[model samples]
Target: MAGYIKSPFNYTGGKYKLLDQIMPLFPERIDNFIDLFSGGCNVGINVDAHCKKFIDYNDKLIDLLNVFKNYDLNEILIEIEGTIAMYELSNTSTFGYEYYNSNSSGGLADYNREKYMNLRKYYNNIKDNYDKFHKNVILYILIIYGFNNQIRFNKKGEFNIPVGKRDFNNRIKNNLIQFINKIKSSNCEFINLNFREIEPDYYKNSFIYADPPYLITNASYNEQGGWDEDCEYELYDQLDILSSRGVKFALSNVIENKGAKNEILVKWIYSRNYNIHYIDKNYNNSNYQIKDRSKKTIEVLITNY
Candidate 1:
């Protein structure tokens, strides 16, 4: 089998790194893969399902996936290239390389920052009146160049992230190409919907993989009044209902974090026949630090398969 597939978007809580630990737990074959909280889509995109339905509460993310699914890659790339040329951000450009590195005082860094801010302003302005096709491409560019490569909007629903410390590089272009090809060939459908809103009948004979926001930890998207304790309970109740109906599911969550324990999660898992698998939460690849040393964080994959 090939190695891990990369996600186009740098979604903060993406499951790309955890796929190795997660994919093997899935059933050998799937008729339809339903991703309940498909953040970056790394999981469902990699799963060997005949068809896929990716649902997320984040509408912007669903929009991005839809853009890739419906638009031409070359069309999007042309806009990207034009933006790159306009900003003089080619790989060979010294200004592009040093803009995010070393100096922050003056010269290339300042110039690149100015260009980025201008691009952001232009994107924000044209968001309403610009061509829809071009808007998708422009939104893609904003995400890649925005602060921390996140899809964060202000209370006013405007893309409000500041200029990031990086530019459009070869890796980004390659990731975009890979994403376009994968999404195009993967037979996937993107839907913007909350987890609870999905109907029970829609999940018959399908395998669901949910990677929801950790109750103990905080993320940008976890805010905006989403994913609370009640939401977690509702998710568990839904999963229990599914299990009763013979639907298979695998959900990832943090059982413990930073000296705090998710007692509710612990109780729920122990109260049922769900299988629990411990996942290595560490991203660092070092033998020097043993598993026992990192006791503060505990991640688990709870499944009803």
Candidate 2:
């Protein structure tokens, strides 16, 4: 409850700032807790020992999680050190994407494709079952070393972040086994899935947090990412379903829904009976400016079911 949990990845729209505010809202007693759209695992790290399930939807994100699964994590930390010993500036964000994806033993590429191409398909086929594990800690660390710690893929599902941006060696695992030991006590679980396939009945007595892609003009999930319209609608439907099922739900999204600017989000959420928490925050990846600041809307749906 009084320690910092760090993620080696540079996750976009991460909730590191809101962590303090979020902790107080967790259900007093939870059979399991889930960060459904967990990006960087920031929330998972903080919720550490308090929850059981740490299901995440991002394959690349969970690929990194697998490293923490012990076998892969220990090896990854070793490789990180080896690569750094061979070269300096391992944490610089100036590295190239091709360096890792091209030379990797098809580990990183395969893991990402599983979520990119067949995300919807896989989500429907199994819905909530998470079985496959990909050893992608090296890939994420490499990506974090390059391009401002950005993890992105082209429409073709390829990691396209440029290299030599930042050297990853800067953040070496000072004491790896101990680091993994910290979160391992939390019984952390990683899940690779699409939002549309999540069932409403699964949320009973669970604390759910969602940080979905912001609906904005030409926003490609990420500069190197993509989000289809059908999938978007499906995600919204899934959230609405989760709301009615009595799940403790909280979602971080931009106010822009339709017709209205950012204002539409507030009205849209209220119309559904969800309490809205408004806060002014700096939009990620933007130049620091007063005008660049945007209002982040956190919608909550609480029920006694």
The lDDT for every candidate, in the order shown, is 0.79, 0.54
| lDDT score at residue 125, model 1, on the 0-100 scale | 77
Instruction: Please count the clashing residue pairs in each candidate, in the order shown.
Output: 0, 24
- TM-score of each model, in listed order: 0.88, 0.68
Indicate the TM-score of model 2.
0.68
* Model 1 collision count: 0
Give the per-residue lDDT of model 1 (tens digit) for 196-290: 88878989999999898888777777777767899999999999999999999999998877556899899999999689999886644322135
Measured over all alpha carbons after superposition, the RMSD of each candidate to the real structure, in angstroms, is 3.5, 9.1
Please identify model 1 stretches exceeding 4 Å from their true place.
Answer: 87-111, 127-129, 283-295
Global fold similarity of model 1 (TM-score): 0.88
- What is the RMSD, in Å, between candidate 1 and the native fold over all Cα? 3.5
Q: What local lDDT does model 1 show for residue 219?
A: 78
Q: Could you give candidate 2's per-residue lDDT for residues 1-305 as a string of tens digits? A: 24656665666766766666666666556656777778776776666345545555556666666666656556566665554444342222234435444322322343233222232232234322353332253454445444456676666545555453334433434323444666666677677876666677766767677776665533334344445445556766676776676666666665542222544445556677666555444444432233433432232322222
Candidate of highest TM-score: 1
